[model samples]
Target: MEKTDNIQKKIIEDVIYNAEKILEAFNNELDGVLDYSVKSLEVIDDDLLSQFHENLHDVDETMKENAIIQFGSYIFEVARRNYGGKYYWYEQLDQPILVTGQPDFEISILAFEKVKQRIENGYEDNIPFFFKGYVQKLATAKKGDKELIC
Candidate 1:
């Protein structure tokens, strides 16, 4: 029992640590627009939502989809909270562009893919709540690490 408890505690710590890294990167990318304090974010549960598990036989595929949606939602929610709206517009050169434009959307897609790859290839830690690569990619994309819009 004690061993189980310790493992759970460690997993929680890892989640919090990863969350902090993600938020920091996000804030940096937006130049402090988010201003997300660590105290504002919390991990509520580790259980998968039942809606994503209707087809038990396709558990693997379902889990992948669920993870993708959840991660995407998290990204969208953070943007919304910080930007004070669900979406925003920016001008690139002389063209107006939506924040969730192709490149930005691809970031979320790639994040899901990375998580899926990690799951299939095997991960050292059983904790599936966070993927460091996904978080880094998001941070980079948001920070305009590539040709993406900030």
Candidate 2:
């Protein structure tokens, strides 16, 4: 009985330790992603969007298609970097961070803009709710860590 109990306790402790490490890594990754997104937004000049559209209009048919493909690829890279990529290490943690984005550049931009416009039009309530859920999960995981320590 004593040996069984000891083994169980050890297993629980190991799980807790692993969970803590995963959570820390997740938080660090999220911070980095958020910073990158902010920087990307900052670098977008006022006329860049218009310029992109204008260039698309002026290019030959083949070049236009190529430009569209390249632009889509670029958007995917940015989205992947900013919104969690192929390996979601964070998902291994107690509270996983769910990343949401479209792979299609046209749809991605349209959706992003729609969301932005909605928020600007006073639909900001959902944003807080969404973040609250994420924050609560993190807090819960932190509490779990403390419980494990005790």
Candidate 3:
């Protein structure tokens, strides 16, 4: 993925690299257990959600913080591979967001926040359900339904 926009590019390079590393680690550690399919949100669940939640109190601050990026990076990769999403730095929020633009509409995902939410609230923040809903909405969206970027 070449740099597209100046704003998004600023962080996208690091994000892309981190995302790739996360995927590679998964392939090795899980022995290719987690497939980067449409329902690949579990990649995040497997990578850090399980750890962070299981050892919430025992974990160090650095691991806790890094887990967000590590898990979120995997989420971005899965979304990119499965949903045709791309990373763009959102200047206002100052973070890279995954944007999957369809002919009818766009599916923008705050992948890190999704990870953070899952780490904090567990299943109530349902990353799988979120992607499932987005897939459903994308399927139902018509060309003339209006172009929404969010």
Q: Please name the candidate that would achieve the greatest lDDT relative to the true structure.
A: 3
For residues 48-83, write the lDDT of model 2, one tens digit per residue: 223444454464766544333332223323444545
TM-score of each: 0.28, 0.29, 0.76
Candidate 3 lDDT tens digits, 1-150: 244666556556677677677667666776665566765566666564766776778878787767777767766777777767556676775667876665556667777777777777776776777777666765676654532232
Worst 10 residues of 3 by lDDT: 141-150
Q: Which wins on TM-score, candidate 1 or candidate 2?
A: 2
Per-residue lDDT of 149 in model 3: 30
Residue 5 in model 3: lDDT: 65
- Model 3 CA lDDT for position 90: 67
Model 1 residue 78 lDDT score: 43
So what's the TM-score on candidate 2? 0.29
Clashing pairs in 3: 8-89
* Order of models, best lDDT first: 3, 1, 2
lDDT (Cα, 0-100) at 30 in candidate 3: 68
Top TM-score hit: 3
Query: Tens digits of per-residue lDDT for model 1 on 80-132?
Result: 34432212222233211113223443332222333333334433321223333
The pairs that clash in candidate 1 are none
